[model samples]
Target chain A: MKALVWHGKEDIRCDTVTDPEIQDPRDAIIKVTSCAICGSDLHLFHNFIPGMLPGDIMGHETMGEVVEVGSGVNGKLKKGDRVVVPFTIICGECEQCKRGNFSVCETTNRKRHLADKVFGHTTAGLFGYTHLTGGYPGGQAEYLRVPFADATHIKVPAGIPDEQLLFLSDIFPTGWQAAAQCDIEPTDTVAIWGCGPVGQMAIRSAILLGANRVIAIDCLPERLSMAEAGGATTINFETESVVERLQELTDGRGPEKCIDCVGMEAHVMPSLPDTLLDRAKQMVMAESDRPHVLREMIYVCRPGGIISVPGVYSGLSDMLPMGAFMNKGLTMRTGQTHVNRWTDDLLRRIEEGEIDPSFVITHTVPLAQGPEMYQVFRDKRESCVKVVLKP
Target chain B: MFHFSNIVRTKGDPEIVKGGPSLKQPADQLARALGWFSIGLGVVELFAPRRVTETLGMEGRETMVRAFGVREIMSGIMSLSVDKNAGLWTRVGGDGLDAAALLSGLTSDNPKKGNIALALLMVGGIAVLDYRAAQDTKPRRPPRDARRKLYPNRSGFPKGIESVRTAARQIAAHAKTHLKTHAETNEVKQGDERRVP
Candidate 1:
C-alpha cells in the first residue's frame, strides 16, 4: 500500500507501507478512495504538536468502500459499505460517548497517559495526529483500519460522490461544531478569526444556524475573498486593526461570539511587542502554541458573551490574560470536534444542497504528490485552501 | 441527533453494546494521567531548560531547571512503571519541591517576578489535582476489570486440545454468518442504493 508517511520536521513522503489489518473486533478495513490534507496536519509536518516517529502514516479526512469487517462489528456494517470515517475514533459505549462528548472517549486512546500529562485529561483517539491522540495509522493510504466502525463512520448515500461527502470525516463537522459552541441567538453577530477550510466552513455554518451577521477576519486576500463569497463582512487584518474594524462592525459591543479558527500558530501582523514576545517564547521552546488569537478574542468578545475556540491550540504554556478572562465574565468552550456528533446533520445539510464543502478543495492530486502539496499549503503558495489526494 | 436508525443501519447501536467504562469509574486513569503529565513537562524542561528558566527571569539557573526536569521524568516513569500509589505520591512530593523552588524565584530579584508568581500558582494547582488523584487510586493492583471490558478478555480461552477445536468452531461460525449477511447486504444494497467495491 502506498501512503503519505511523516519522516521528520517539514518532511512527508509517499512511501510503500504495509496495508492495515483489523486489530480489534470493532475494527473494519476501508479501501480509501479520497483523503485530504488538513490544516492540523501542518502542525505534524512542522513538528508543533510533538511525538512523531519516522514512517508514521499521515492523513485523517477520508472516505472509502468498506472491504472487511471484524465479527465484533456485528451486523450493522458489512463489506462493501461506502463510508466516511470520522477522524475521532470513539467507543459508542463509553461514558463520554453516552453524553455525546465523543472526543474524550476513555477507551480508544491507548496512549492516554501521553495526552494526559500535557492536556490534563485524555483526548479521544484521533486517526493520525500524534501519539498523544492515539497514533493509529491514518487514511491517506490504499486501505485503512477504522476502529469502532459502527459508531465512528457515516455511511454516505449512494448518489453522493466522495468529494461531496469526504469532509464529513473532519472539517465539515469541525466547522459546524465550532459554530454550535457559540450558542448563537438568531440576531447575534459572529466573528471568525481564520479563513482556512475550517474557518470557511464555520462561516457558512454560522449562517446556516442563523447568526444575523458573520464577520470573517484574516490577512490573506484569497481567504478573505472566499469569506465574502459566503456572505460575511471581511476584514483584512493586514490593512485594518481587527479591534477597530470589529468595533466598527459591531457598534463597539464586540462580536457576541468570537471563534478562533487559527489555533496554535496564531500570528498577528504589523508587529506588537506582545506578538514578538509570543514568537520569542515559541522560538525558545517556552510555549508550544501561540495565543495571539485567543488573547485578542478575550478582549474583543462582548463582556458576557462566549469565546468559541475551534483552533487546535496548545499554545505557549501558561501565558494568558487571566485578568481579562476573569474580569469580563466570558465563557469559553473548546475541544476536538466530536465528528460523529455533527457528521449526520452536516451530511443532511450537504444532501439538501445547503452548502458544498468541496468548494474548499483548491487542488486534487495523486497520493504521490502529497509531499509537495504539504509545502504548497503551508507556504500558502498558490491560493490553496485545501488539498485532496486520490489513491 | 439525526435519525440514523430510521435512515440507515450501521454496524450496531454501539451505545447498547453492553460494554463501556462506567461514567463513575476512576483510579488508573488518574494515575496514568499524572505519570504522562510528568513526562511531558519533563521533556519540555530537559530540551528547553533555558526557556523555562528564562520565563521565570532566572536566566542563570538553566542547569537547575534541567535537574528538575530530570526529577520530573523519573517520577513520571515511576508513576507509569512502578507502584501507582507510590509513583503518584512521589509526584505529589515533587510538587512540594517545585513549589519551594518557584517560591525561591519569586523571592529572588528576577525582574519578571510576576511570571514567577504565576508559575508558582500553576504548580500549586497541579499539585492539588495530583494529590486528589493519588488519594483516590491505590497503587500496585492494575484496574484489570476496566481494561478487560474496554478490550476483549482473552484469558478464558481453553488451553487443552478442546481449545483448538473451540477456536476453530468460532472461526467457522463467524465465516458462515459473514457470508450469509454479506450476501443479504449485497442484495439489498444493489436494489436500494449504490454498492461500491
Candidate 2:
C-alpha cells in the first residue's frame, strides 16, 4: 500500500509500502479512512524526537474500518467495525491501564530499558512515533496494524463521518484531558497558549467544562479567530505581551489555570540572546526541547493555580524559574493524554451535538499530496490549521 | 460488534506488529547500570561525606567531596531523563569533572594515594562505558536520497495506475456493508445506531 515515508528532517515522501496485517493475537488491521497531520508530527519532521530512522511511516491521528481482527480480540472487535484507534497502544490489563493511566502502560514497550534509562520508566506503545515508542506503522497509509484492538480502539457509529470522529484518536481527548487536569470550577478563568488544533480543541473543552473566561493566545489571525469561535478571548502574542495582555484581560488577576499546548519546538521571536540563543542551542543539541512557552506559563500563571500542559516535552531544556515555582506554590500537571479514559465521555459529547470537532480541518487531500500539505500546514499557508488525508 | 461473512484480503504482505522494541544494546544496559552506580555513590557521599573523604584519603576535603556528590547525583538524574546519546555525553562530562577532583587529591599529600589511584581507575573504567554508550546512540546521518521512493502516477493501487483512494472505494463499498450490518447488530445491544447522528 502507499504510505508517507519520512526521509530526513523536512523531507517526507508518498511511497508504495507493504500493507499492514494483524501481527498480534490482540491486533487488528484497519483500512484507514481519515488521518490528520498532528502538530507533534512536526516534532518528528524537525528531527527533534530521537531515533527516527529512514523509511519510518509518520502519522497518528486516524480513524477507520476494521478489515480483520485476531482471535484474541474475540468478542470485542469484529471485522468491518468502524473504530478510532487511540495513538497510545495499551494491553488494558496492566496496572496503569487499570488505574486509567493507559498512556503509561508498561507491557507495550519492548524497549522499555531505553526509555527506562532516560525517563526512569517506559511509556505505552505509540504508532509511528520513534524507537522511543513501539514504532508501529502509522495511519498515514492505506492500512494500519492496530495492536490491543479490544482496548485501544473506540468504536464509533457508522453514521458519524470520519471527519468528526477521527480526532478521537488524539487531539479531542488530549484537549479534554488538559482541561480536565486543570480541575476547572464553573467560574474559573483559563488561559491557553498556542491556537493550534489542540489549543482550539482545548478552548472548546474548557468552555464545556464551565470555565468563565478562556483566553487564547497566538499571533495567527485565523487560529485566533477559530479560538474566538470556540468562545475564547483572543490574545495576539506578536503585537502584545502575553503576560501583560493576559493580566489586563483578567483585570490584574491572572487566569486561574494556564494551559501550554505548544510543546518542545515552540517558535521564539526575532529577539537576540533569548529566542535566537535557544534555537542555536537546540540546533547544536545543547537541549532536547525549547521551553519558551513553559517559561512564559510559569511567569504569567496566577499564583497558587494550576498550569495544565497538554504539550509534549522530551529530553531536557534549560532555565526554569524554580524560585517562582516554589514561592507561588504552583501545581503543574502534564502527560501524554490518557486517551482511552476520555473516549467514552468525549464521544458522547460529539454525538450529542454539543460540538463538532471537525470544524478545525482546513484542508483535505489525498495521501499522495501529504508531503506537500505538510509544508502548507507547517508554514501555516492557505490559512491551514489542520489537514486531513484520505488514503 | 461488527461482522462480515467474507474477509477481504488485500494485496502485499501483512506487516507483523513487533509489539515492542528489539533487545537493548549492551552499551545501553551498561549506561543504565552506570546511572544507578552514580546515584548509589552520590547517596553515600551526601550522607557520609566523612567516610567518602576518608576512603579517598583526602580527609580535609569533606566539603568539596560532598559538593562532588551533589554533582554526581545531578549527573545521574540527567543520565536517567534523556536519550542514550545525551545521557552518555553527560556521563562523559561528569567523568571529566571527577578526574579533575581526583587530580586535586593526587597533590593533597594524603595518606591513601593508592586509594586515589583506585578511584581514578574506577572513573577510567566507567568513562569507557560512557564513551561506548555515546558511540552506540550517536545520530547516523542518512544519505540524502535514502527513503525517497516515489511511485509516480501510481495512486497506492494494486493496479499501479489509478489513485489509491479511488481503488479503495471499489473494495470499500463491499466493506461498508459489513460495517453497516455490524452497526445495526451493535444497536441491538445499546440502541447505539439510533443515537448516531
Candidate 3:
C-alpha cells in the first residue's frame, strides 16, 4: 500500500508501506476511496504538534468501503459497507460515548498514560493525529485498519460522491459543532475568526442554524470571498479592523457569539503585536499555541455572550485576558467534535439538499500527489482552500 | 528511522516498505543543513570566542563575536523553523557583516591575514548558499493583494441560503408557539390549584 508518511517538519512523502491488518476483533479494514489534507495536518506538517513518528501515515478525513471486518464488528459493519470513518475512535459502551461525548470516549487511546500526563485525561484516539491520541496509522492510503469500526464509522449512502460525504469525517462536523455549541439564536450575531475550511463551514452553519448575522474574518481575500458566498459578511483582518468592523456591524454591542477557528498558529503580522509575540514564544518553546483569536474574541464578544472554539489548540497559551472573560460573564465552550453526534443530522441535511460540503473542495488529485498537495495547501497557493485525495 | 519508528507500533500497524520522494525541496534541505551549521558555528563563537578571535588575530573583540553568535543562533532557530526563508535572509545579512569584519582585519598589521582571507572566502560561499536557499524557500503564496480566483458561488447550500433560513425561521416560530402553549397551560393549572385551595 502507498501512504503519505511524515518524515519531518515540512516533509511528507508518498511511500510504499505494508498494508494494515486487523489487530483487534472490533477492527475492520476498508479500501479508502478518498481522504483529505486538513488544516490540523499542517500542525503536524510544521512539526508543531508533538508525538508524530518519522513513519506515521498522515491523514484523518477518509471514507471507503469495508473490505474486511473482524468478528467483533458483528452485524454493525460488514464487507461492502460504505462508511466515513470519523477521526475519533470511540467505544460506544463508554460513559462518555453514552453521553454523546464521543471525542473523549474512555476506551480508545492506546497511549492513555501519555494523554493523562499532558491533558489530565485521555481524549478519544484520533487517526494520524499523534501518539498521545493512539498513534493509529491513518487513512491516507489505499487501505485503513479501523479500530472500533462498528461504532466509529458513519454509513453514507452509495449514491453520493466521495467529495460530498468526505468531510463528515472531520471539518463539516467540526464547523457544525463550532456553530452548534454557540447555540445561535435568531437575533444573535455570530462572528467567526479565520475563514479557513472549518471557518467557511461554520459560516454556512451559523446561517442555517438561524443566526441573524454571520461575520467571517481572515487575511486571505480568496477565503474571505468564499465566506461571502456562504452568506457571511466577510472581514479582511489584514486590511481592516476586525474588532471595529464587527462592532460596526452589530451596532456597537459586539457580536453576541464569537467563534475562534484559528487556533495554535494564528497569522503573525506586524499589525497584530500579540500574534508576533505568540509566534516568538512559540518558536522558543515557551508556548504551545497562539491564542490571538482567543484574545480578540474575548475582548470583542458581547457581555454575557458565548465563546465557541472548535480550533485545535495543542497545549498552553499565554496572556489570555481572563479579566475580560470573567468580568463580561462569558461562557466558553470548546472540544474536539464528537463527530458521530452530528453526522446523522448532517447526512440527512445533505440528502435533503440543504448543503453540499464539496463546495469547499478546490483541489482534487491522486493520492500519489498528496505530498505536493500538502505544500500547496500549507502555502495556500493556487487559491487552494480544500484538497481531496482520491486513492 | 522507519525501522526505529516501527518499534513503537503495536501488533497490526503498517510499516514502511520503501520510501518515496519527499515534499522537502532541495533548497529546503539546504536551508536545514545551513541552519545546523549556523547553530554549530554560533555555539563555538559564543563559548569559545577567545579561540576564534585569536585565530583571526582580532583579540579583545570577544564581545562583538558573542553578539554575532547570538544573532547566528537566532537565525539558525528561525531557519530550522517553518520560517526558514526569514532565517536564510538573516544569514545573508549576517554574512555581509561577517565579510566587513573580516576585511577590517585584512591589514598588514594582522599576523593572521591568511586565516582572515580563508574565513572571508568561506563566508562568501556560505552567503551564496544562504541567498539561494532564501530565494528558493520563499513561500509560494501569492501576495496579499494579488488577484485571486474568488469563490462567490460556493454557498455550500444546495437549496439556496434564503430557503434554509426560511425553514429555520419556521422551526423557530413553531418552537415559540409550542413554548407559549406550554406556558399558558402551566398558568391555567396554577389558577385551578389556587381556586381549589
Best by lDDT: 3
Give the runs in model 1 whose Cα sits over 4 Å from its true position.
Answer: A268-270, A315-318, B1-197
Candidate 2 B-chain TM-score: 0.57
What residue pairs clash in candidate 1, if any at all? A76-B10, A76-B11, A77-B11, A117-B37, A289-A315, A289-A316, B85-B139
* lDDT (tens digit, per residue) of candidate 3 on A290-381: 99999999999999999999999999999999999999999999999999999999999999889999999999999999999998889889
The iRMS of the candidates, in order, is: 28.2, 17.9, 1.0
Q: Which has the higher DockQ value, candidate number 1 or candidate number 3?
A: 3
Expressed as tens digits, the lDDT of each residue in A1-391 for candidate 1 is 7877776655577766546777779889999999999999988887778876655678899999999998899876898889999999999998999999999998888789888897788889888787788777788877888988878888888987788899989898899899999987666899999999999889877876667789999877667777776768889777788999999998899999999999988763446567766654564467777788888899888899899888897544446887988999999999989888887777876787656777677789998888888877886766678899999
lDDT of 2 by residue, A251-369 (tens): 88788899999989777688524666666567557888888888888888889999998888878989878788778889999999899999998888778765678878888999888
- What lDDT score belongs to each candidate, Candidate 1 first? 0.78, 0.78, 0.93
* lDDT: worst 10-residue window of model 1 chain B: B148-157
Q: What is the TM-score of chain A in candidate 3?
A: 0.99
Better candidate number, 2 or 3, judged by lDDT: 3
Best by DockQ: 3
Q: Would you list the rank order by TM-score, best first?
A: 3, 2, 1
For each candidate in turn, give its C-alpha RMSD to the true structure in angstroms.
22.0, 15.3, 1.8
Task: Please state the CAPRI-style docking class of candidate 1.
Answer: incorrect
